[model samples]
Target: MSEILHSPGVLALELSPGATPSSFTLGREAADALARHIADDLLRLLPAERDGAGADQADLLVLGALYDSVQLLHPGWPLFAGLSELAHHSQALAGAEGGRIVAFGSHAGAMPGDALQPLVSDPPSPLLLVPWTFSAPEALATDLGARMESVFMAKGEAGRATADFLMRTLGVRLEHARYLTRHDLCALICSQLEHAGYSALWQMLEFALLYPTRSGEASTARGQKLVFRDGAVHCALPVYADWAAAFGAGRSREERVTDYAGWLFELRQYVALLGAHGVAVRFDGDAGATSLPAQRLAEPDPSLPPPTLFSHEARGLGVVVISVAQIAPDRRVRLLAHAWPLDQAGFDVGLPQFAARYGASEQLVRLGGIELDATADDLAVTLPGPAMH
Candidate 1:
């Protein structure tokens, strides 16, 4: 059993768009160049801490993969587990002399994906990381960890030559290359998501990542509820009552009903974020008085376009269909909401035709197999276009 190191660090690269290669992976030459430069950087950062023989500073092993900019979910557990394992292996092989560096690079191509899915993101975010571990005596490791963070924060720029080499080879416009502990990375991501109006979503994600063993709960601005436990997210979709409490306060009942579409849009946005994180979302149907039960479908019903929102002129709004893939069949089941719109074309016109003309019906989020209990009579409508506003 390889134990996780007490002190793990990361080299942070802040990249701006500048004709950068689509992939984040560095080939043999680039990877080797990066490793050498990182070694030099570490040497300069800690000149006093040489190995026992005083021949080399420490063992800094950089992983071959360049990791994509992740949301800092789970601090660094499974995300950086492989790096920890690699360091342990190297130490065992070499008798454990020094610290290790685990690097994660990326390219839009053949590189393996992490626990987080959608390996390839459109318009990649402006960040990349190289994770490393510091192996030393407990006292020295603690002191070194504190020093490493401050050193990298203040003067952790990559060597000028290395930065130039990377810019030319990777084709990314350079912003600033520095170092940060995993804690720093977590705070950075939290701030970023908060600035982007995702504070509520971050709360749940952070809890899911950091508190995997404990049960926790979170809610969206629109009153959608989420419970995290047993390695999955259980969501209780807001009913008309919950929706009204959030958005219908001052407005008349009719006006609130008319604006119901706004709530549906918000729900879709939340679902999309969960899917993007590859979070297994289980719609909790029995928690509230509203009986909105959801179950797993053997396969996606091709007849219906993915998970969509359907609306009609007279009916105000129709159903907000939601579908999520089956992640753990034994412990959990996926969810899908089924509902139809009210149109003059009558029930005979069918959702397919009704969606084509009156309601443009946009697919909200599509994952895997899931089904909703048809008991909820309050199916609403969806607007046109797929993008969440």
Candidate 2:
């Protein structure tokens, strides 16, 4: 904290146009703080200290963690100053003891050409990993011990903060786009759908974590499921993020509803990604329709209760949104969304043809009808081009 406050022109963070950091500024942080985290990771890899041999000597020996941390904070290129700083401190500390100054270089998959042509090293040391040398039994006990420590340490907020520090540092060290997982991608897509006018974006993360909700009514409490059947997929939002605020106190109703609007377009860009990958989407039927797999089960079947999700399909079932999550290997995925009604002319993905309906009968949801001011400006960012890589 003091270092960040005192340091001038310290690199802080980096992010895409609309993306937020994971817990912290991520790419932006003081170079030293980032270096410290790297140092800590290497320290963890050392054997348990019986006499502080590894502890005192490890910092004096390895500069891998610090340099790797820098790469993580600034991926695609390695900073010479940052690397030199680590090497200088480490070599000085070792002080002619023949202590090896092992430090990180261009990361795996990263090339010398990836960095600036001016980049140079004073004395180079290759990146290294701590080898697993413990016997099987010893390794198992160490694993269990670490797990136990995690459980007990989480009791303290300090532990949680430090744990997060380590986790985020290690996360970037593992891979470039390693922050996102299947579950997070679900939340990401679902959040975007919510930003859209599509309202069925509830409890979506629960589905990603516990996919294939075929276990009966008990699964309903967990929320909706993204289903694929007969060459089509179905999904419905079971809960809303604004509604989650009910459990806590913060925003007023208007503020909640207003800020709530951006959830969809935030992820709206993903819509085209789905389509580009040969996915077909349609919309039909009411979003609040009472349909579920339980519809086919016996009346009052105690074993099969109704889940919040819709099980079977019907015509005119208006779908709010459709999102997809890749299932690895070949990027195959299960489409998740509300029930979309099929049409001969394809998806009528809009409020309805007003000119054709002008002579016909259809109810328009007006501001007067809903008793809200329609004079408010429309606030939404149109989806940009697809950016899936």
Candidate 3:
């Protein structure tokens, strides 16, 4: 069987972290202009060939959305397949092609339906990516890929006219516009995560992106460990047996629970970050234990029996239930807790409501979690903000 080949690439517009854009996409005329500029830049960057091995033969497909790099890594919607299909259909339309450039603008009569809609900007890492492709033999494809990667890294800035036009039309603060192979885009995202103090977590995330067939493990400085495998992130919650032996063994139960609360808060932050990156998360009591759906930690209700204690409820009741279970004869037990919904508004306010209704001592033992006795007041503790790495 002959091997099938597809060469797909993306040109990214990376904005400063704090930079703001008024619109997520461009209007028709502006989109067309940007597409033209991309074509011109690529033609100048890639040498012309008699056999059409240059940018002249390439296809540039522009979309009207800012993208997060992780969205590009979605296994469900492989980037090359999606872009190629879009380009194929667009190219077949008699008037849609403009010398190898096709822009998917909001005002363009051919807007994709919601199901096929691309991922839009969130918190705005705000990469306006224009994906391009080439049809060539395997060797020519490899050579073209190398040269594009090299030249784009060296001098891929958008032309002056293009930059000005983007700023004026899209109302964005221009930072740096560059060409990136899809791989380069992933590296750029990994670099940004490292700079943002997620260096430890980046390794697993990168593996989830590039090495989906294998598993990867990593740990945060605070001792939280995570593994990426089978298309989801399985995190070993901090209050597990091994972690307790190292950090909680000598501490009082109250102190241990307090420290555990802090760790639980940090886990929430990680979950939010992963969600932003479009990755699924699950919980593991130990590094090698059977994984539990992350929702168990996200919305816990220990009001039921032992096994069902960790089962998740559809709606979060605005409090974390630290459910305790005995697993051994030596007084060893497991403590499972969840964090408040960080995404909801007035969540902190819900904290007080929970405390007022539960009372201090009555609910802890009744809930089948830790028996806080008279000091149950501590269970309603206010968690601190995301800890700085």
Query: Judged by lDDT against the true structure, how good is candidate 3?
Result: 0.55
Question: Model-by-model lDDT, in order?
Answer: 0.52, 0.27, 0.55
Model 1 lDDT, full chain set = 0.52
Show where candidate 2 strays beyond 4 Å: 1-32, 38-204, 212-349, 352-367, 370-389
Q: Write the per-residue lDDT of candidate 1 for residues 48-109, one digit (tens) a residue.
A: 64432210234555544445545334433554565555454443322223544434343543
Residue runs of model 1 more than 4 Å from their true location after superposition: 1-3, 49-58, 71-76, 87-118, 135-140, 215-218, 252-259, 286-319, 322-389
TM match of model 2 to true structure = 0.24
Best by lDDT: 3
Superposition error at 192 for model 3 (Å): 2.2
Better of 2 and 3 by lDDT: 3
Candidate 2, 56-108: lDDT as tens digits: 13222211222212132221112333333434443232221222323333234
Rank the candidate models, highest TM-score first.
3, 1, 2
lDDT of 1 at 113: 48
